[model samples]
Target: MSDTELRNDGRLEDEHQLDADDRLRPEFVDAVLDAVENGDTEEAHRLVEPLHPADIADLFELTPDERRAPLAAAVADLLDGDVFAEMNDYVREQLIDALDARQVADIASELDTDDAVAIIEDMDAEDQREVLRAMEPDDRAAIEEALSYPEESAGRLMQRELIAVPEHWTIGDTIDYLRGHEELTTDFWEVFVVDPAHKPVGTCALSWILRTPRSISMADVMQREQTLIPVDMDQEEVALRFQKYALISAAVVDGSGRLVGMITVDDVVHIIQEEAGEDALLLSGAGEGDINEPVVDSYKARVRWLIANLFTALLASFIISMFETTIERMVALATLMPIVAGVGGNAGTQTLAVTVRALATNQLTQSNTARAIGREIRVALLNGVTVAVVIGVGVSIVFGNPMLGGVIAAAMMTNILVAGLAGVLVPVTLDRFNADPAVASSVFVTMTTDSIGFLAFLGLATASGLVG
Candidate 1:
């Protein structure tokens, strides 16, 4: 095969090969880099021509910002709506800034509502308004309405463009309308049947339209029962509904049950990814945690949590300070104190991780809250005994003081049990008060484990007269 005839997939070059998921192969990426270095724009375009828009987006993401301009210019027209839609937010914003408002609006018009909103939302308010003004009046209005909703809500996430027909329309009429209409959404799985007031009354799958007789009324063929999402609903809740129902797509309705938009599986797929990532980041006290974030912004986001942690650490120190007399009197207490606190802290962190995940996924609710707490308590007891026996015997042999060993063992058992309880209870309590469990729970758990560990070890030492 000629070099052009050798498809990236190792297939003989053909138009059909063009439709394949031709990712930017390592060689192609290398070729682009080499061409850019050599200032061979034609060679760069030739190398990029075979890749899909998503692949192009990936290239942009992988390339450094310095190389992006040359690479983007080399394949100028190829950066169409699909490629723009798939680009990372940071990259897309940068690229959009390079283009004028009209150019950005032109590209935005080709994308679906959710994708369009995503592209423009990151732009400055003035740029956003300019782009909106450049759009068709109807499209501009729909986007403006979406922009008005709180960010990350269902309204902002849904696509305003969708296929809907009056319930009274016959199957033939619906089919004809679909085939003839230029304004309908390019991709849809179900055609919503709406009432005179624009409320969604039913949904008819594409298969039903193709199979049913032309004369059948949509009302007769449409499934009357349908899942409708409220515009103001949380995106996470929308994802849960999609998961629960195994939905391909669902209608989005306003407060009065009027059909306003539609959310497809494509949108939900992004939501699931975003929500999962957000939860993981929040658990780590990282805010949004985007790599594109400025260093100062990142430091500012994390410092607040670190500051809160410093205070909690001080509280733990105060508990240890109260027992300074005990530590000074018995130097061995210093050697053994960390063992109690470290193990308890680790155990508490494990429980806290599980609890936060459960709460985020809605697996832990009021009905089973008590049962979960009881289960943790029992597990803690079992774990405490197992660990205490091993550590106690080891300490007894090493310190040559059975009393000291017994004291450490008792403290370990007490602290670990408290750890388990605190881990489960702290997050739940925070959630109950409408606070994010992931954000605030770690600080509380740290405080609990440290304070308890110190108190248990020191009090045991003082009461047993081990210090005296």
Candidate 2:
């Protein structure tokens, strides 16, 4: 095969491909680090030269903090727009901080409008202004317009470079225009056909344009049924629209319904990944939860949750204090009390995770809330009964007190049922009140399970005259 064909198929023999695990091997990373540390900049460049932009980003991430600058200097020429776009956010921020504002502007100018906004958005206001000043006027205007939108909105995510043709043009005219205009965006799946006022009326897939007769008018050949994303819509909502409508690309319109930009599937993929990770971190009260997150930031994010847990735990302790006399009288009650609380807490967490995820994905809506609740209640019943029987039988044999076992069993069932109810209700209630269910649900759920578990078990023992 010819060299061009070989490169296209990724079958070039000289290309350094990723390993089976798709990670840079330890030895390779070590050698490059050693080269940078030893002041062999040329050698370090040679080692990283064969890697792709993404792999080069990985190399920077893998290097020690002290070595990252030196390694970056070694591979400075290769750290282009693609490499910066592919770098981890924390790593990219570290590199951006190391560069001058003019240098940063140069890098931003090389990237697409959306990517340029992403890089600039994280800088402080003074640094942002400096960088924007250094950029070309047209690039600065596009970035400024994007930055005006709320963070995470479609306006921030959509690309400014898109093909929009007047609906009055025929296929032949459209084809000629596209062929002649070398300044048009190089990557677009569809052409948006707009009216005189720039309102998007229909969309024509590139494939459709290629197959249709050139004599046909753009208005007649274009598909009027199109998914239009609002400029102010959240990126998550934008992703959902793309998913629901099976859209490869959609026109983004302003409040007046004028076509402003386009959102393609590639942008949605990143939003989906970020949203998924954000929810998972929020559920655990671990802000960002990224390994690359700063130590001070991680501590600040986690300490407040830990403090909240401490207070809730004290509340559970107070309930146990009320039953201190009962626990002391029967050591068996003390031994088995933890089991009740532990099992109930596990059950509650399982339910909380499911409910939080469902709510985040819009799966648990008002129409299905009742059904979702009923389903969890039944699950709790089965789980409670099975656990109660196992613990009851074990206690009877070990403590030689079937009545005591029966008392503990009853407590287990009661606490588990309460846990199930608390788990679902806490998140749903928070969501209803405009709170993030994932961030606060676990705190409330754990408190409910612990306090109720202790109260039910001790209260049952006291009432049955099994203890005290």
lDDT: which candidate is best? 2
RMSD of each: 3.5, 4.0
How do the residues 1-468 of candidate 1 rate in per-residue lDDT, one tens digit apiece? 113334546543334344333445555566677787788988777767767688889888877777788888888888889999888778888788888889898998888988888898888899998999899997798789999998888899999888989999999999999989897778899999999999999999999999999999999999998888999998988998999899999999999999999999988998899888887787778987987666788899899999998998899899889888889988988888888999999999989989988887788999999999999999899999999999999999998989888988999999999999999999999999999898878878888888899899999999998866
What is the TM-score of each predicted model, taking all chains together? 0.90, 0.94
Error of 2 at 453 (Å): 0.6
Q: In angstroms, give how far residue 442 of model 2 lies from its true place.
A: 0.5
Question: lDDT at 159 for candidate 2?
Answer: 88
* lDDT per model vs. reference: 0.87, 0.88
Clashes of each: 0, 0
Candidate 1 ranges beyond 4 A from true positions: 1-30
Q: Which ranges of candidate 2 are over 4 A from the true structure?
A: 1-23
Instruction: Give the top-scoring candidate (TM-score).
Output: 2
